[model samples]
Target: MTDMRNGSVTLLEVAPRDGFQSIDKLIPTAEKIAIVEDLLSAGVSRMELGSFVSPKAIPQMADMKEIAAHFKGREGCRMSVLVPNGKGASLALEAGYPDLVFVVSVSETHNRANVNQSVAQSLDQLRAIVAEAGDGGSRLRVDLATSFDCPFTGDVPLDAVRKVAGEALVIAPAAEFALCDTTGRADPMTVAHRFEAVMREAPDETVWAFHGHDTFGMGVANALYAYSAGVTIIEGAAAGLGGCPFAPGATGNTATEDLQFAFEQGGITTGIDRAKLLDTADRIAALPGGKTASHLRIVPRGRAV
Candidate 1:
């Protein structure tokens, strides 16, 4: 069941990391920090600020260390960074981040393309990474990319996802899992069914999150269905800014404003200030190559455009 104790839903803003990483232009570190501050002011308590990856592969995230330094120890916000391996995890821990997300794809082909490793190899590396970060007090989360469908392999078997997730739990018993709709191929029904199955398999204390791309315009629907199936953590990017550089034909994630609007209308509280979030979305849209795919941002409520 969705946690409605305070009539609020947890939304992890991913624009600064996931959204900005896909842009061809380098976003200045100062600008990134300002945008993150604005998001915090708009009631976003959790955010994926950036990734600790090779600068050559993702130059946009070259300044993750600086960004992490800026937000470290800030009150009332939980900062998370994506770590690709043990080395990345070391950097994140050294930077004082309290949470880390490691991504692995269910489809072997997509997994190789995204991380240049087979599923077994990645898990082997993950075991080492988990051991290296052992009892570090930092929270570890696994993002099972291509859990729904893989661009290279087409449909991914639910069993494949379950197997990888099961392995991840064995390696990091305290880790959470975020099922990713990497190519936006998941519909509402599929989202519900898959989430239910995973939930049934996950440990009692395991936390499950949903990461959906909006390639086919069903991101919000899929997220809502996941929520219906006991998922409480949802990821989104402001102005729908993001795409998998490694996944061909993949698109931006669900727009933060769009998801907030949908959840609020459905009587789910997101704790986000709608007006402020829309304003932030507009600001993001004005950046170079800032054009977004969010319906609400393009066609907002009230007033003649």
Candidate 2:
């Protein structure tokens, strides 16, 4: 794993899971597979394809197993799925997903609303899940949602975020920690300071990533700040598709295309083909009720603004 803190960055494409989960319309399984294929073809190596939660909770992800089957045994791509609990982890195991993302919100109110568990209770459940996956060859990634701000509780305290992240590391020492801007309310300075604080509090080898939303149009800026503050992995959605169904005032994630453009323009390599990525963004936007918040997607590539 290259140190993202050193300058090299990796963008984890989260559209298939985070994006699709929020859509009201059910996208066909084949269409979902096609989009995943296009993303891979466009040089996106890491992707969150779907989640393993109950269909009733997130009907949009009902086809998780089918979607997993389509990409089974794929090589050269790091595929992951969001698992909210032990049952979700078991489902992902059965579906053959190797990477699982477990979310624990920093806000007590948001955690209760999102998963019906307090932070302590969720960590207990997460510990059990990690134990159950012992020697199963599955890797876990813990995401701290509302790490910066929460809709229900306004600004989250830095200590609260650090505590959750520290405890999460104890449960899965090798787990990657993603500091999420759930509502896109994080400013650049705050983002830099908080991330620096997290790195200091957590294990030196712990991989830190950023997941930002574009609700307030600061998604890209916040991400750049995160990168400068030593975060290497950044997660985003194709065509800016995302939002928390359980979160009030939540909106789309930073557009993957836009992030790639920003990184490349700053002389940072993301290994994504700009032209191919743009084409894939168009395909994503063509889906039913699909739209993008990527500025580069709307602007011509060669045109000087």
RMSD of each: 2.2, 2.8
TM-score of each: 0.95, 0.94
lDDT of 1 by residue, 1-305 (tens): 34533355788899998899888888888888888888999999889989999999899999999999998889888888998888898898899985888899999999999999999998887787787678621388789999999999899999998899888888888887899999987898899899899889877788889999998889999998888888889999989999998878888999999999888877788888888887787778787877787878676668722
lDDT of 2 by residue, 1-305 (tens): 13442355799999998888877889999999999999999999899989888998889888889889889889978999988888888888888886888899999999999999999999987897787676322377888999999999899999999889888887888788899999988998899999999899877887889999998888999998899888989999988888988777878999998899888877788989888888888888888988877777766668732
* lDDT of every predicted structure (CA atoms): 0.87, 0.87
RMSD, model 2, all Cα superposed?
2.8
Best by TM-score: 1
**Pairs clashing within candidate 1:** none
lDDT for model 1, please.
0.87
Number of clashes recorded per candidate: 0, 0
